[model samples]
Target: MEKFPGAEEWVPARGGLPKVAERLKDCRGCDLWEDAEQVVPGDGPAKARMMLVGEQPGDVEDKEGQVFVGPAGRLLDKALEAAGITRDSVYITNAVKHFRFERRGKRRIHKTPAVGHIVACGPWLAREREIVKPELVVVLGAVAARALLGTGFKVTEHRGEPVELPDGTAAVATVHPSSVVRSEEYRRDFGLFVDDLRAAGALLA
Candidate 1:
């Protein structure tokens, strides 16, 4: 197996996110890259005005090598449509590029990447932001919120409110679609989640 180039030694040679991502194909900044079948990079038009950031790849996503193509992804698609946003119009990615998990029999349990892991992966996330330079960023859950805004940022307190980053970009926090699906009260939360997505969509409009 080919090892990822060390983060310290890796430098992006081009100006686009895709180009940067190509370089990350050999990324070994963290151990997550080792077990992951492949790194899932953000996908969408280069000029998209909105960027959606999720926590990390799930089982199906890891296997498919795409962002948000699983159950949570389906929910996201529905929510985006309800919000009057086309999935193809915005960029979608994760805080962590690789999927981290524990194997339980035949199933792969999703594990949240650690702070150090997220920090190690920050450069890639930052590069995506720089390349896309979206007008607004929607953080899908706590992990993305922490990755983008630092550990001090709390999703509960700051969710639904837009915060300005140092780069002058605006960001809004919201629960991940998976959370809604996991809840016993899916109907209520799903409505709220769609509403939040609509709100985020409106910002771009």
Candidate 2:
């Protein structure tokens, strides 16, 4: 077993979004960066009322160096609209900054990031949260939920529920938009996803 030094040292002691984004490019936090095309940092306003945290950058995001611009992201935009939230208003990022994938011929299939990868990239996420200071954090899927909550946290058991973070910010756990995209019952699953987002939105009231 190998030990990771983590991203703590790579993180700026105190800086705004631009500084963090600039420094993030040079991070050798974990092995994920070795195969990834580039780091996908959080996007949107520096300060937002809500923050959407996903698992990691997907294939499109990895290549484009942006967060949530792929199919799942498009689905998320629709879901957010359905939930009465605007896409541009919230900060969007991932628990892991780099894309983790396995190659098949020329296509790269998405792979769930290992725990080490998540741990290594936590500092970056923390800095984003500090800079954004969002009143609410919406975690998309098991990975994001576990990253902010705990390894024992179960998204299935608590999806759509408002939970408390260590910093006292509210958090909502829901299935990732990619899951809805891959579902056989797309309409039904998407409806449920929108419902979860609505629940999260209600907390803002």
Stretch of 10 with least lDDT, candidate 1: 1-10
Write model 2 residue lDDT over 55-169, tens digit each, in one string: 9999999999999999999999999999999989999999999999999999999999888888888999999999999999999998897789988889889989999887899
TM values, all candidates: 0.93, 0.97
lDDT value, residue 7 of candidate 2: 94
Error of 2 at 63 (Å): 0.8
Clashes of each: 1, 0
Question: How does each model score on lDDT?
Answer: 0.85, 0.93
Model 1 lDDT tens row, 140-201? 99889888887788887877777876677988789999998798998899888887888787
lDDT of residue 191 for candidate 2:
92
lDDT (Cα, 0-100) at 125 in candidate 2: 94
State candidate 2's TM-score: 0.97
Candidate 2 backbone collisions, by pair:
none
